[model samples]
Target: MSLSAPVLAFEENSGLDTAESAASCALKLVRHDALSKADLSAIEQLAHQPAARHSGNVFFAPRAVAASASLSRGSIDWLLWFQDGRLCLAAPVVISRIASFSLVRIWTHTYAPLGTPLADKRLRPDLLFEELADRGFSALACPLLETGSTLATAVALPGGRQDGRAGFWSGIAERAVLTSDWTEAAALSAQRKKKLRKMQRTLPLVHRVLRGDAARDEGFRQFCELEAMGWKGAAGSALKQSDTALAYASELVASHGAQDTLAIDSLEDPQRQGNQSVAMVISFEIAGRGVVWKIGHNTDYDAVSPGYQVILAASRRFAAENTPIWIDSLAGPEHPLVGWLWPQRLTVGTLVVPLKGSHAPARTLSGFYQAEARLRQVARALRQRLRR
Candidate 1:
């Protein structure tokens, strides 16, 4: 924490619609290394707050962000929103230079499914964009924002039709989500469920939701090792393929688990001598929201659908625990298994919002962004098809 860093002050009213004096509040750009303990606490509180619009997530939580920072390719910076001289919203972003343009985007790992700004209930997204623009930024690049979120809806809509929305926006996409209800747990066809049940009876499967350090460590290790031995290994994209990626993931799990917010759900064959795990799922729950982060299964158990069984185990746990919000699938939108099994779905996408404007600049910037976004989507589709 840098006590000597100059405080960057703004003359405008706090972007937060808090009851406090709409008096002047400051916006400070504090580098990760300079974040104070107080700032980190504020972020955690906002993320844990049920009333916060798009801020309720574990990805941007202090320890998670810090762990991600260690493995990130860009420098981490925090943008704080203050109201009545108190921190109201925060966005941790990675600032970089792209083709003579300064790109400020949400600080999220490739696997992070949400880019929600850590914000107060009434915090406005445009306020942050305007602040960035005043600091010479052209726009804010936010990726993986939820489709139905107020801010995301405005960004995805043509022409920023909503009042006080982003000046311009682009790139809308959809992701899968499963409602945390027992009703949603059996969305698969009756025949498929019957097959899974029969496989379970034959395998004598033991479902475990590991939360303790020792147990979770072992289970997560099993998961990473399993993933590495499968297709991800062939693709050279498994966590164990990169020392740093694996270490960072371990740290992230440990950090979140310390708060009782992480779990490793697994299915093991109790009939086997060593009780070997056949499948595993890494999940994080903060307050009411749950995220199904990763899944891995032993190919040897494909006939039993170990992967699906473990997923079902996780879903049942979430429902029994009464998880308030839906669980993000984190799997691709086109993912066959989870997408077919989980009836509910949500959209998420990468988008850039032109800073503080309504007319010519917004139109030109948004049009260019939409065109680029289409190209990127086409490239991604081609890659997927090629891989298939």
Candidate 2:
């Protein structure tokens, strides 16, 4: 499918009013084989709203969809629901052939994150599943639902017909949430604090949040390069190494930057005037919350623990913000780096709904898949035990 041009315009508005409008307005669903210009614009607008969650403007953006779809052998469907001329729910569905049946996912493999159809808490999500299946989707999978997300309830069918199953696939969608009283020093031990203090005194490092276009662009590019410098680069998974990734990152900065959603925090080394950045973090503000999406640092500065320093500075900055928002370390539960610092683990799960309804065959297939997944998990645990 041919993708339309990228649209990055989004304006913040009152959530209550939007929800009310969505509840009362007439709903209509429009499906396109390829992403249409109007749908792209509407999707971005929905993504920027307070109702959206995790990787809101980044993964569901037009550029992201195009990139992910380009690399996958699947069909793309840009589905949008218009309520009284306003875009209410935008669901980008990817359909891939799996054996004799087709598998449906809210997202393609191009993007790491996925999003469900945007809807108010009052809406019944079963309607969503029925509509998609009526339109030819074999099954609908929501792979990125937060533990307490409204989608979990919104998509539920009446009469206990919500036959979908949700499971916590560790390392799938984890986050670190910090309270108002969170402190950088609290995350580090006394010995580590002393060492960090010494590093800070030696170089007199400065942490700044870059806001200007040139500065933000440079910071983002530097972050990509820094990520490419380490294991990600060696493993050929770095964003800087892929043209599609470069474009997606560029669009994220442009779109979110315009709305003041994108934030680039950098730890600078004055001694290295030519290369001031020792560590950097790329984060975005959503619904008054901060989501730290990426972090990178120069390995050469490991002696000073520049990576930890940068994270500390960013966390402190979030704490000091007048808005009183919590910072979410998007790193998963098993992340060795951020796990030690942020003790809290956000619960996330995936909801799978069979479009064909809960038939005997569908039930059997679901049971088989669940058994297979459990076997894999058990085998993985046994391997870890053996290693120990």
RMSD of 1: 6.9
Residue 322, candidate 2: alpha-carbon lDDT: 32
Q: How do all models score by TM-score?
A: 0.83, 0.75
User: Candidate 2 — worst ten consecutive residues by lDDT sum?
Assistant: 1-10
lDDT of 2 by residue, 341-377 (tens): 7776665444555565433333344455446545755
- Cα lDDT tens digits, model 1, 87-156, are 6667788887645456677777766657877666555444545667778765576666665654554233
Query: Total backbone clashes of model 1?
Result: 0
Look at candidate 1 and give me any clashing residue pairs: none
* Candidate 2 structure lDDT: 0.60
Best by lDDT: 1
**Residue 167 of candidate 1: its Cα lDDT?**
36
Model 2, residue 366: distance off in Å is 5.5
